[model samples]
Target: MQLDRTRIVVRQRGVLDTLDLALHVLRVYLAPLMIAMALGALPLMLINHLLIAWMLPDADNLLDIPARYLWHMTILIFLQAPLASVFATTYLGQAVFHDRPRLTEVVREVRKVAPRILWSLVLIRGVGAAWLLLLSADRYGEFDSFVDTFLPLVLVTWAIGLRSFRPFIGEIILLEQNPLVGRDAETITVGRRSRMLHGPASGDLFLRWWTSAGTAILLTGTVYGTMLFLVGVLTNDWRQGRGMLLVAYPAAIWTVATYLTVFRFLTYLDARIRQEGWEVELRVRAEASRLVAWLVVAASVMCWTTDAFARESTDPIEAGRQALSAGPSYPWYDKQEDGLRPVHVQPARESALNRGSRWQAATEDPQRESSWGTSVLNALAQGLRWLGLIGLIALLVALTVLMARAFLMREEPGSDDQQAARGLSPLEADRIDNLPFSITQPPKDLLAEAQRCYQQGDLNQAMIYLFSYQLLALDRHDLIRLTRGKTNRQYLAELAAQPGLQRLLRPSMVAFEEVFFGKHRLTLERFEGCWQNLDTFHEDLQRLVTP
Candidate 1:
């Protein structure tokens, strides 16, 4: 379950690894993280002490009004945003290497990602605030709901659960070499990447979803519970309205924010590992490094052992006698005037796995020059590749045809209910609307009746006339059967079988109810559009029905 942080590989794992990784980040970066938070707290503390406390109507009350609660968060997040940016970026840097940046560098990194951090904080908190407003009915804008109230409980649960969705938002922003701008850029990127993170429906996000969500809930509970307990004890008055509740809440908020920041870095790597074959890459590098180490060990052993070994003992006693009589046993030992002196030796070259991996990598070298035979063989291979591609395409086409045939042959479970939105009865289509101005009579020609309604500016009747034109045309073409009642959705569903009809008629159907039943004003442009659509359907119907 312990990940090799050096290789930075993610694997298909269960829940235990998720908790382990979260704790791993906490253990490894606890010191630097505290320092970062301490620095973050400086600004937040200043604002809370000087500005926010005095500004609130009842400074001590954490649950006086929803507006006050909103104001508290607005100020808190404003100060925390820059420091959070620093925390996220620094964790990313350390995730790459054990070396975390210095304070100044962390600050610089934060400044670099200030736009993304501030904007994201604003957006998420803004959304959270909106949710609170809609759900909680107290003061429109203040957090008057107490700790014991359902509102706070709901807010806490929501915040905890919602963390998983945007886990990589901070990482994406800070690490995105080319960043996106505008309101929903971060939102768009997070949603897009979440697809890759969770993966396809077959696995059903089992790997990413369960792990991240579970870890989020667990960490939220553990961190917030401990902090809340501490805040209560320190304030010595949980029941009394102390502003420390405000401070305590922010502390818990920052703790989760920071923890998730680091935790998400690992999760992001896991997503990459699944998507990019990082496990394979890491294995290759590890094997290469092991091979290189064995080689170095063998070389060192050879250098100092056996007959051919350069550093093997050449009779130390004899060499000492020889040093006094002649010079030295070997030329490597300097015949210094003051006995044997140390020799300067060159350091062994360190072998990197990356270099060895490149050496052992599966690759083919291109021929600088080709012979006639080689050229002919290459041309033959290229021809074979094209033939294979064409064969594959043909096979795919055959497979698709088989699947479609199977689908068409299969009987639907509900024969009665699943019947195509059938052609309407004449009585149904020509039913009198009984409008204030319109004459109540069935028309001989449905299209002409529709035209008459349009001419009279009876939009309600005109829309119904247009719908009748579609149903009649469809029935004439035998595309649908007669049904006494066919809802718009039912029509659209049945029309799905006929792509041309679906495409041409879908918009008109959707607009039908709105214009006819929902008080749409009469307009020439609208009338013309509806008439043109009906006319288009009638022409297509004639062509299909003619033969």
Candidate 2:
């Protein structure tokens, strides 16, 4: 046997390390668990999408919007809850136990935990729905116009603050030991969840949750949104988009749901290791087992001593004498035939001359010791080879970086080429009469004329005049010397320098650009809103400049 001694040492890990281990574990299981969850949620998603396609009203149909939203809400609560519970329960099991999660086991666990999961979901969803109603109050005419913008801002800020220490309600369902059947468990579970979340390790727990679940939600949304765009493009039919979500929504569900459930499990373990001194407890338990073994041996020796004395005479003095006569029973192995025997290492019986010759033979043998390993020339050659490899790698990396820089830094087209291709760049100024839309406005009445064009259903003409009015106003206000070849951004920058005009017309310009050149469909609501804002700003400017 080769006598090569190697050792692997394990030590107690602190919060960050424990979390790192859990993250590595999660990474290994992310794919299998995701696959299982996606498959489980697939059927529900398909049904939801199919129903939505059949029942959802056209965007223009204001009367049916409320009914459509009600249908969506019904599906979200009843159907989405079960699908979510399956993913959460399954991933939690995998994270807690470090096992490859199976969909069948997930179903079994879901049955046991179903009520709690449903209640947890209901509480979360109910609060969110209340917030939605408050924010969407604009549609039903229940709140001031300002509330539409203000409430959503407040809600976003509140959500961000809440994430700092979001209640660990899910942890309650996962960690409770044989929790009571119904209401009692729910009450106790929430209390325990609160305790765990507020403990000393809560900061680490929140960071872990944000890093895993928060990031997953963002990435999942981006991936699914991109897929939806591609699918819409390939099919050339936006109406059939609902059917495509059957596949897409599963990917989204798999990412965010699985991450959130697994995060709860990791946090639970981190809290235990930090608060319970789990490593010390394990070492103490092992020492206790050793102590018990020694006690057993001591008691057996006493019994043997007492028996010997009893067989001879019943006196304490006699027991000591009998013990000496009986001698040591243990190690009892020495007295048994099959017991372990001491190895009596044999000494070399060879003479000094013979041993010397054998030693020389071994030292000279190439098989016993390689001269090449220690040779100066060979060592130099090996070092040179390693240096050569390193240089080659560095050269390849340098080349790659240089190539990327060159590609990015290539020269763009000239002003002449740009103007030739598109008449004028969006940034450039042009003749008033050369405007794309036909207009009946002199310079002084451009604002009133733009409004008339807008009222007459000529959105394109309206946006052009609105945009032109802003540029002409800025030029007269001496904000900048207008250029025939100026870009939209240059016009914006020129206006932004004037605090009065910047405050008034900056937003209007952006709205103008979106309508003037962007592909967004011009709806009546958006059209009216933009027109009113621009008109209000135009009126304010006239008052500001008119002395």
Candidate 3:
């Protein structure tokens, strides 16, 4: 019992330490992330300002409009906000949980992708502007009557366009930084490489985009509505209604949320593509389908309530007796005399039994009886059913998972003596368990071996070890596949072809490329750092690799 208690305490401490590290990483990366978002937003804001200046110069209420537009544009460009939260959450998540790249390294990589990000942003803004123009034309009745009748089509097309471009900016940023070369990229490549490698497929991209957009709209709308309700209540002045503010807030929030969601989805999608290839698309579709199922369930309940209410609002006796009685002879009803008979008149005691019988016969199921007050009751019940019960349960589950994950992603702090004695892996469990990390190699002893080879004047051997170590250990999975006693050049070439490790391995590989292949000298400090990283990487590998 004492030993069990000690173990529990140790586990708790481990979890707490991991959370602290994650929070620390978040603190370190938040500033640069905000800077990146701000940079992304600048052009969009400028464009919005230019549009306002050109189109609405004389409007006296233009100041607030610009503020709103700025908010919207910020969301459109940056994708998610509390911009600080996204940066903090994502960067920290990657650093703490996945050992793929350091915070600074990832930021540097993102910086390199800025041009691609900017181009995608420009394309997105162009699409938005074109949509606004079409909407304006529609409002002004510029189209023929037949064309006007297809307004829904126009709206759907606009929606599709918005959805399709939604992921591109983020996708470009992520892919540019983490380009999968060789087999890793090839395994995930779908369609004809010719077609898939170009612009995103309309159907698949739009599905993801629209699904993200819908979620953003729903979440933002709920938040906005709550705020509006609170404001209305607090002011006690419905006459000075700020309900319009709600609409504007959702639009602005939607812009930002859409961007964030798309970016997040793209990151996951890319990771999934790298891990499981085209199956990522299927997983996304499955998620969308689940959401659709929820919506369908909600809609079906509403429809049932509406039908019940329509039946209940009429006098029950009048609906059942008057409508069903007298058959063809009834003034308000028409029916063939022999084909249909009037409802049976029964004694009061037997009336309940007769009603039950008729109801069962009509419904074709005894269990599906509709109460007289079902309409109003069902309407109230539906809201309570979803919001009170289902929504609360979902919220609780989400919170639990987040907290659990946060706890799980901590390093177990202890002395090296204790770790070694306990046979604990040097690489923390928190560091190697989650995404990107799942595919990354643990830092190991390859650097030391490489250095020894360098000192021995076997420059090619040293280069191969360094290159393979960096790629197989730092960027890819835990496993290192060294060719069986192969020459340095052969081993390095083979390592380059490993799926999912090449892109991350490329930079360090480049460093070695010059040192060995170009016969350039490597600095002691740089070489030592690589060695240290390799030791840590080895520790990580021990944790990941099962005996």
| Highest TM-score scorer | 1
Stretches of candidate 2 exceeding 4 Å from the true structure: 1-23, 30-32, 35-106, 125-164, 177-189, 196-214, 221-246, 286-547
Off by over 4 Å in 3: 1-39, 53-107, 124-169, 176-208, 233-263, 270-547
Compared with the true structure, what per-residue lDDT tens digits does model 3 show for residues 311-424?
778766566666565554654444443243456666555344457574433333467678879978998899888788887899999999998888766433554555456443
Model 3 lDDT-worst window of ten: 4-13
Task: Give the winner by lDDT.
Answer: 1
Tens digit per residue, CA lDDT, model 1, 1-547: 1223462334654445755776776777678776776676656556544534443455445356445544445434532443454554555555564455576777676678677666664355343343344344433344444522454455444543444343455566566523553363123344344443442221423445456546555765676568657766976754424343456555655666566555556666665565455665556666777788899999988766664545555787666667665753553455545355666789645445446564544456686787999999999999999999999999999999999989877645653232223333434433322111123334556677777877787866777667766765675566765453334545565676777777777656544544543445545665567567655666766777678
Prediction 2 TM-score vs. true: 0.37
Q: What overall lDDT goes with each candidate model?
A: 0.56, 0.53, 0.45
Q: Which ten residues in a row have the lowest lDDT in candidate 1?
A: 430-439
Instruction: List candidate 1 stretches off by more than 4 Å.
Output: 1-10, 37-86, 99-104, 112-166, 181-241, 289-547
User: How far out, in Å, is residue 74 in model 2?
Assistant: 17
- What overall lDDT, based on C-alpha atoms, would model 1 receive against the true structure? 0.56
Better candidate number, 1 or 3, judged by TM-score: 1
